[model samples]
Target chain A: MALDKSLVSGSMTMLILKLISERDMYGYEMIDTLRQRSNHSFELKAGTLYPILHGLEEKGMVRSYDKEFAGKTRKYYSITSSGMAQLEERTKEWKEYSDAVRGVLALEVSVL
Target chain B: MMEEYIRILLEQIRCKKSHKYIESEIRSHIEDQIEENMSRGMDPETAERMAVNSMGDPVMTGTELDMIHRPQMNIKLIVMIAAISIIGVLIHSLMLHDSFLQPETEMISGHYLRDVIIGLCVMTGICFVDYSVIARFSKLIGGAIIALKILLIVKSLIEVNSAVKWIGYGGIWMSWLLFDMIYIPIFGAIVYKNSRQGRKGLIKSFMWMYIPVFLELLSANMTCALIMLISMTAQMYLAIRKGWFGESYKAAITALVSGDVATPSIAASVVKAFGSVFPTNTFNLYRDIVAGFIANDERNYITGMLRTINKAALLFGDSSSELSNSMPAADNQYMLTYINCHYGIMVGIAVCLLIGWSLFYMFRSLIKQNNQLGLIVGTGCLMIFILNLALNILINLGAFPIMECWIPFISAGGSCIVLSYALTGILLSIYRYKNVYPSDVDVKMPKLKLLLEQ
Candidate 1:
């Protein structure tokens, strides 16, 4: 659940890459983190998430490995350099988006 | 924990539903929720429940999601309209090219659009409108199907270019103007809905389909009629599993064997006319001996009379290409060639396998119930689609590689593509949106027969 909102909301895809940025996690784990990180404010449903993940995997934005962990073997994901680059670009865009939104909301409303 | 949730989520997807897209979505949401909860120091179990909860009732949520995501947007429709319209125009021009190939692109394009519009409107009317509304006119609908089959007779008689393709649309030779398409869909709906009671009802429902097909074959429009017959049979087979299979199939076979095709009055006359003629006839000599008792119709007799002239067209018709020598004695499926050309036969094979595997897993749950009828119908429909595609491609290759066999999803004829997709949407709407059984939500639901569990 510990995810960067600036990254997750703008395009949670980079967030996916960021998850894989450090280590590989399977589809389920990737989704869980996005939801928990958003404090239930942003629930990453399967509809939105899997297609992005699939797109990422299809584009080789990330790579997956199946390994035996705990008791069950799972398909874990890791970000490729392409994914990392995508994450960085998305993060920059996110920061800019947040700042712009903040600036707009931050405007003093002359209550007329 | 998220993984386990996904595993269970997959189980709940139910075979009757369209799970292709949403399967991934559900998995994503669960994972997203779990990660958030886990970071908050919630245990895996707590995280899992929280994630599932955030998914906001999978049924309602899935329906909403599909509405947003599935391809029914105006933009998509327009693109489809443009592409399909062009194809339709091309076909029209090709059919009439011998008359005038007026070397102008713009004029031809406009004509194609007209065909596109007709095809699209018909398909749209099928998909969007309430099937039940269409069902009420079952007698009229069934009659209309029979009527369309009869058109082939007209085609055979006034045929041109060695093919029984056109009906006289004023002065034009209208080829592949598929009015009979409404037959399979409307007939399928009627049979499934009407036969939802007892075996006799089911059998009678099937007769709705069979009579038209027999009429079609007799009219010598065997090709289109065969497609409808096969598809309807597949649909009926599905209805049976839905516990709606009536004596329709049996009735049809009996009617055919007994030489009775239509109403009782028609049946008696047909048998008599044929029975009285063939004292020394080679075929159906036995049927002729007993034909005094069994009944038949003048419809076939009438069609047989018509076919004498059409038999020549059959010996030399080319439905696809307008050129006299463009097609072969036989035509194959078009969709397969397109797939093979674009994706390669290898990839096409793989894609089919992937689809097959998912479908297999899907029915695994449904088949877990003992509703043999539902399983049979579902499997039969799939088989029919497969067979239609295969036969269409074979026909195409044997004659013209550029064929009209439709790619249900991939093909660009907006009308046809949309038509197939509507079925997928229905399943999703029922399973993911409505949740499990299509219910009268207020009433206690009867368990629909399932192949998996009793």
Candidate 2:
């Protein structure tokens, strides 16, 4: 099922940080990687990805540079040390959040 | 067609100065999207449309992009400047206290305070505007300021050696020196903006820089002119070192060796015109005083001022106040003396430290920016402030001959207050956008020497 953008928006930065931490990726590459890794549950457009990446850069959470690839110069964003720390914290929070929701649902099913 | 769509998106991005880099990145993203769709058996046209549609609302995206690249302000610098301005006002108030009960003194005091308010308002307004926009229209601004200086020079000639730098309107002196000093930043911008245009551009930039200096000298404000010249030359040096002039030396030599009648004739005419504009008698008079070729009477005036300043510096009490009370124009030419007399040597030291602190911040901000316009304008502002403080101190110490320049913010001139604050505002404006460019380009980092073993 396709997730509503608003539902996925809160964790977008965490997802981006986690993706880039594994390897440096351009905007289009990150979008493709996120879609495949989430089993096509999450898909990001250029508009969504570029602003987040640029914001990350402004905060020094991520850094970007132009590189020649596949006969075209593309801007690639790499996770910085700050970005890794941010991702770790966000990941822990998200796990706790999902577990709480699952626990609530499981309790409701048991009551039924 | 895809390019046009991308252009439309970028046009809405407010921070258009950095559009090229953003455009390339966005263009690559769209191309990749189109390729992905086409590989799935979609036609190129359908894929292109799909890719464009998927990026979301252009306006929203543009706004977000603009926010990401917007200029960030330095608040700490602003607070420091405001605090210094308040200190300046308090010092001026204290110096004027004896005459404060007089209506005329009270009126003058009111206007000085008002000018500071108005000047700060102007400064705050300038901070919001992009400095690149200001640099873009510097030619017109510089020309208008130069014209005003010319008019003032003519007026000063009519007044006949009054040494008055301003015209009185409603009892307030509107300082021409302050207006002329502003041309330094505009001249800096012109030099830096045209830095890449080769030898001809360099000559044109220098000509623009020379106009205000020439005008300042004609008005008999030697100290102000020197301050501006030093600032302009420093900016020019930075531009040249940055390779903005782009192989200018080779072009200059080639033109000189070849019959290049244009370059040689132009140079000769410029020198001739400048020589004619500088009056010989006035030049000799000022030159003599500066070189200590002064007559006995002039030497006496110097000695008298020196004796008063020395006594004030040493006595540090009622004796200093008594000496200052006896001196003519004690507050005007004897700035350090008055401060030293009333507040003691420690206060004077604190004032010096304040001036040094401001200069330190200006240079620190200059190093933190990579933009050529910001660099040049920052350097111009830095030198103007530093030189004005230096010249005033040197004159007060009897090292340099007395010339009509204010003690920056602390001195009692309405125009001086307005202009000094206005200049500081510009410095703050430049500092606010210090990081607009990328890190390497904006900052001048030292090279780390690497060791090599054979």
Candidate 3:
């Protein structure tokens, strides 16, 4: 099932930070990688990706630089050390919330 | 089609500086999408349409980007500068009132007030200017200032006294050379924005740094030359340490050390210049003159008078002994001493603290700047303020030899007042645009070959 837009929107920064934590990426590449990794589940829009990336940059959570690829300029974003700490905190919170949701859903399935 | 989309999208954003990078980034993304679609067997036109559509609403994206990229203003900095300028005006009026000459109090105060007003206006105007434009034309601006100084030096040689620092017409005079110190910040921008990479860039920046120093030395203005040398060298060292020129630290240090070793020859040349300006006996006379000033000799007595006044200065009220009205240049060079004598030491200390607090605030803001050019230019301005204030204060306390250095906004001179405001204006401009520019924004200048051909 495709992820809900609202759900994805709320966690977009954490997701983007997680992606860049593994490796630096340009905007188009991040969108592509994210889609492939989610098995086409999380298809982030370009408009959505850029604003989050820029916001992350302003917060010092990510840093950006320009490099040339295929004779065209591309801006790449990399997660900073502060971003790593944030990702760790967010990941722990997400795990707890997901585990609780799964526990409640399993109980309902058995009752049904 | 992509251009139209970008144009519409950019129209929604208020910041002009962010437009360049945003346009390029968005255009590149769309191009990548078009390529992907073509790889999947769609035609180019249909792919372009789909890519544009998938990017979502232009206005929403633009507005979101704008929210992150708006300019910022440091209101506290503005208030501090205003306060300092007002303090300058009041102190100058006080000095004129206490003057033994009693020269046209109204006329002189009016002139000082006018200068302060003009300075404040200039500061406000410069605050609105985009400082990146300076980076774009750093070379041209740096060269022009140097040329103008050289022209003035030539003019000074042709005139009497051979040390005419001012240029005047119709009874209006301006100390043109005093404004040359603005070049230090411009030099920072040049080194940061214009120089090429590696050893060649390092050498080029050094050459640029010394040209003004050389000119000042030639003109026999030792104080200006010394200040320029120290500030520009500090800037160059900063650039090197930041790896802005992409040179190894060891190599850069070696060059810097060699440069320092060469300074004694420069000092010798300065001494030689002074020797030519004064007779051999005058050297003995100069030593005796300095000795006299120290030993309270009647012929050179201002330092001794200042020392005595300082000893009797009260913490919060006027000193027991009245401020000497016969003190020359009391309104400009010795402003701090005048304040200590008339207003009490505590008031003088408060003024120093105010100036110090402003510098500290500015330094903190500059350190937080992500933009390298802003940091460099701002540092140059900060160095000037610190150096001038330190020298002026030291001279006032009789700890150092009295020179013509004017405390930034506290001194009572037209050019000094305007120059301080202009430097502060640049700092304000840098702070104002801190958020608008990305750290890696490219400031393009015309090619040297094209310029040469023209």
Candidate 4:
């Protein structure tokens, strides 16, 4: 997973866009789910994850809400239209990349 | 299907997380694990324990998980502190002008400048003195102030009112000037230590706090008592707001049991009330006080004050008047409302409030995000202002009534204001040079001790 740096990073970006496409997620929860899905393979430390989320929010990839619940407040984030469009583009790119790798692996044994 | 498993998952989170987000995330993840285990037929309680075990230890996890709270320092605050202390000292000096040889206007103005100089010195002294050392050995500093107050009370009885609030010899509290000096260190210590902010620490500071004021009040000075009370209130308010009084508010407050209040009543209560100073010696100077209390003969108390006033008038060469020696025989704080003589009291009180509020606001700003420095000095300034209010109200007007209480950089002349400024300067100087100002960093306390010891 560490060696497949592009896959890991792209997967995180995809997961965040998917989660926020439905509802805004806090940085903490977003990291938590990403880790659980990958079975602790992606240990997204808060120090790293928060900055990415902030950067995404700044770049119009996400909208944020400072809201309260159960007597405590949290800042939540959701995907913007630009984020959804980027996710569509990335998904297409990911499928193409994987198909190309698979095609290379499944080359027919013409000699056999 | 896994209701019991859900219950077990909730138990996994026992407050290990400091950050709210991490706590909930971990808790819900545990819930998910519990449900997964229960689908395979694990019991709810065992599933809960297993889930908690899997997440990691609560203590270590929580610390690593939570975000830290950091407050920033801003500009408005610094200017306020510098302005307040500087201006407060200048204004206070005007009242201390000694009209001996120079023209009255020049003397007054010159004395005010002297206050400014002394005030600067005080700022430098306090600013430079390592507060941690003062904090580390606050016990010694608190004890010293308490002792001085006791000594002054004994001396006041012997000298009767030579303004022994500051000085004393033998057992009499006549040197009001010296008696007032101890407050500089007493209230200073409050700002010094209470700013450290622990229940035990503040209590320790309070013990040093009331001793001198209590003794001063006992010497029959009403103004000092009021001042003492205000200082504590302001200190407590700020300390509590800053979360320095521990986690709970209950411990911050203690019983207000005054030892003297429990003692038997006497005519001197009135004398103490009006004459506004408690005698240094707890023992009666005149043998007839007990008999006098029984007979309700407080006439001598008024007469005693009159004789003292008459003496000051003679010394100052004021024209004689019978009413000059005695008040309207009222038993109240506004003892001077009828006299209307000291027109200066009105101006003094008004100017005092304006200046007092300004100083308090400024110091409050200076120490705004800074609980340590703010708490100590804020409380000190507050206590002094409390003293100011009582004096402003009780002081008899018409002519210049000799002030028996000290007002830091104001009211009294010579060493009074100058010494105050020097101490203030030292405190500010210590604060200026010391790295990690509020912390009890071991490096600075030793230097503070050396400076203070000097």
Give the winner by lDDT.
3
Model 3 segments beyond 4 Å from truth?
Answer: A18-24, A36-39, A59-63, A78-112, B39-42, B99-110, B156-159, B168-170, B260-264, B270-305, B323-329, B440-454
lDDT of 1 by residue, B1-454 (tens): 4555455544454442335434544564466557778999999888888777655444444444333332222333334434434543443444344332233322433344453555555545443443333444555666764675566554544544334344456665544424455455456446645653676665576577667665544433445555666677566655654444444556544543343325333533543455333233212533432342232433223223222222222222232223222211111123333233323455445444544443344344333322222233234334434544465534333321222354333333434444444433222222222222121111112335642466
lDDT of 2 by residue, B338-414 (tens): 66766666676687688778778778867645455777887887787788787777666666666666666666556
State the number of backbone clashes in model 1: 49
Cα-based lDDT for every prediction: 0.46, 0.69, 0.78, 0.48
Report the C-alpha displacement of residue B1, candidate 1, in angstroms. 45
**Who wins the DockQ comparison?**
3
TM-score of 4: 0.44
Give me the displacement of residue B104 in model 2, in angstroms.
Answer: 9.9
Candidate with more favorable, higher TM-score: 1 or 2:
2
> How many steric overlaps are in each model, in order?
49, 3, 0, 73
Candidate 4 stretches with Cα past 4 Å from truth are: A1-112, B1-109, B153-163, B168-206, B236-254, B257-357, B370-377, B386-412, B419-454
Pick by DockQ: 2 or 3, better one: 3
Candidate 3 lDDT (Cα, whole model)? Answer: 0.78
Question: Candidates' DockQ values?
Answer: 0.04, 0.29, 0.63, 0.03
lDDT measured at residue B232 in model 1 versus the true structure, 0 to 100: 70
User: Which window of 10 residues has the lowest lDDT sum in candidate 2 chain B?
Assistant: B438-447
The alpha-carbon deviation from the true structure for residue B332 of candidate 2, after best TM-score superposition, in angstroms, is 5.1
CA displacement after TM-score superposition, residue B251 of candidate 4 (Å): 7.8
Model with the higher DockQ, candidate 3 or 4:
3
Off by over 4 Å in 1: A1-112, B1-126, B148-168, B171-177, B196-199, B245-385, B396-454
